[model samples]
Target: MSRQVKGVVSMRKGAPVELRTVVVPDPGPGEVTVDVKACGVCHTDFHYREGGINDDFPFLLGHEAAGVVAEVGPGVSNVAPGDYVVLNWRAVCGLCRACRRGRPWYCFDTANATQKMTLEDGTELSPALGIGAFLETTLVAAGQCTKVDPAAPPEVAGLLGCGVMAGLGAATNTGEVGRGDSVAVIGCGGVGGAAIAGARLAGAARIIAVDLDDRKLELATTLGATHTVNSGRTDAVTAIQELTGGFGADVVIDAVGRPETWKQAFYARDLAGTVVLVGVPTPEMTLEIPLLDVFGRGGKLKSSWYGDCLPERDFPMLIDLYLQGRLPLETFVSEKIALTDVEAAFEAMKRGDVLRSVVML
Candidate 1:
C-alpha cells in the first residue's frame, strides 16, 4: 500500500519549499521505509532549492536525519523494524572495487531506493542525496540506515549524517591530525567547528580557527579551538604561521571551499604537512596555483568526499562517544525548529545566525 505524508518540497528553482502531500510506496526488494524523527536544515538543502545541485525540480530536500525503521522489504537484513538508525547517503556496496580493496569508504557503488517517491499528482521527486528526510516518513535503501545507540537524541545524532561528520573526518581521517600537532581550520562554521572538535579529540596541542565572522570564531572556541583569527581583518596564512611558532601548522583544513581559502590552507601548513579540502565547491569555480608550489609543498593535498566516512563503521562509534560525553555532538544543534520552519532555518543559516537548525518531525 502507498502512504501519503506531508513533505517539504522545492517545486521550482528559487521558490520557497512547499509542504505538500508526498506519496511513498511500500518498500521493494533491498529497501526500507523509515519514520523520520529529526532532520537538520543544511546548506545543501538550500542549494537544491536554488537549483544548484541540479535542475531536478520538486526535490525532496533534507538528508541529515535520524529515524526508526518501520518496514523492510525482501533481502533486507542489516536493519529491522523498530531499530533506531542514523540515515546516511553512502550505502556502500561490498562488491565495489574500493570495497574489494578493503576501502569501503571510497565505494563507487552506493545504493538508494529503487522506487521513487512522488507527489499526489504522480510527479517524481528527486531526493536530496538519495535520502529525502524532511517528510514524516521516507523510503530508502536498507543499507542507508545504520543502527546506532538509541540513547542518543535524534536531533544530535542526525547531524552525523552530513556536515558534522565531514568536518570531523577532515581532521581525523583525511588530515590525519595527531597528538601534540598544530592544526588550523579555515571557516568556523558547522563543518569547520567539527574539525576543531575532531582535532581536539585527536589530541592536537594547538588548534587555530580562521573565519571572517566573529560569532563563528567565538563558537569555535567552545568546540576546542585554542586560537581564533579573523581572516577578514588579518592574513590567515601569516597569522597561522605566527601562531605555530613561525613554522606553520602540521595540518591545515580548508572548510570554506573557496579558492582563496584553499590557497591559505596550502601556505599555512608546514613543509610536508597535510592539507585537507572538505568543503564543496561549485562547478564554475577554478583555482590557479603554480605547479612549482604544489611540487615544493611535498605533502598530501587531498579532497575529502563525504569525509571519507563509512557510515556503518563510524556512526555507531560516534553515537557511543556522544552518549559518553567525550564528543560534544549536541553543541552542533544551535536550534530545534518544527519541520515547517525549514525555510526560515535556511534564512538563519544564510545570515550565519546558527550552527544548525534542526527540524523536529
Candidate 2:
C-alpha cells in the first residue's frame, strides 16, 4: 500500500523548500521502506534548491541520513525490519563493468527505487542523490541501506552517509595518506575537517588546515589539525610549503573545489605527491593551467566521487570506530533543527555558521 509522509521538497528553482505530504509507495522487490530518524543539511542539498544540480523540480532534498528499516519487499534479504541503517547514494550493482573488474566503488550502475515517490497530485519527486531521507519515511533500493550499530546516535552516524564519508575517504582511499606523511587540506568545512581527522587517523605526521574563516580553522584544530593557515591573510601555498620544510606536503586535498583552490593544491604538494579533489563544482566553472605544468608536476590529480567509498564496507567500520571513541563523529553535528527549520539551516550554512544542521525526525 502507498503511505503518506511529510517531506521537505524544492518545488522549483530559487524557491524555498516546502514540507508537503508526499506519497511513498510500498517497496517493490529488492527495495525497502525506511523510517528516517535523522538527516543532515548539506551544501549539496542547498545546491539542489538553487537548481545547480539540474532542473529536477520538486526534489526531495536530503540524503545524508540514518534510519530504521520499517518494511522490506519480497526477495530483499540484505536487510530486515527494525535494522538501523545509513543510507548510501551509491548502491553498487555486482554485474557492472566496474564491478566485474572487482572495483565496485566505481560501479557504473548504482541502485535506486524502481518506483517513484510522488506528491498528492502524482507529480514524481527526484530524491536527492537517489536516497532521499528528508521525509519521515522513504523508500530505497535494499542495497542503498547499509546496516550499522544502532547504539550510535542517528545524527552522528548519518553524517557518515555523505559529507563525512567523502572527506574521510578522500584522505584514506584517494589521497592514500599514510603514517608519517605530511598532508594539507584546504577548506575547513565539514568535508575538509573530516579530511583532517582522516589524515590524523591515518597517522599523518603533520596535518595542515587552510581556510579563509578563522572560526573554521579553530574547529579544524580540534579535529586534529597540527597547523592552521588563514588563507585570507597569507599565501596558502607558500605557507603550506614553508610549514612542510619548503618541500610541500605529501598529499594535498582541495575540498573547496574551485579553480583557485585546485591550483593551490597542485602547487602545495611535494614532488610526486598526490592531489585529491573532493569538493563539488558547478557546471560552468572552467579551469586553466599551463599544459607543461600538468606534466612537470608528475603526480596524480584525481577527483573523488563519493570518496570512492563502498558503503557496505565503510559505514559499519566507521560506526564501529565512532563507538570506540576514536573517530569523534559527534563533532560534525553542529545543531539539531526541526524539519521546518531546513530553510533557516540553509541560511546558516550560507553564513558559515554551522557544519551540519541536522533534522531529527
Give the TM-score (vs. native) of candidate 2. Answer: 0.99
Can you write out model 2's per-residue Cα lDDT over 213-329, one digit (the tens) per residue? Answer: 999999999999999999999999999999999999999999999999999999999999999999999888899999898899798999998889999999999999999989998
Q: Residue by residue across 1-361, what tens digits does model 1's lDDT show?
A: 9899999999999999899999999999999999999999988898899877889898999999999999999999899999999999999999999999999989899999999999998999999999999999999999999999989999999999999999999998888889999999999888999999999999999999999999999999999999999988999999999999898999999998989899999999999998999988776789999999999889899998888899988899888888888999888999999878989999999999999999999
Residue ranges of candidate 2 with Cα displaced over 4 Å: none
Cα lDDT, all candidates: 0.93, 0.95
Off by over 4 Å in 1: none
Q: At residue 356, what lDDT does model 2 achieve?
A: 91
TM-score of 1: 0.99
TM-score of each: 0.99, 0.99
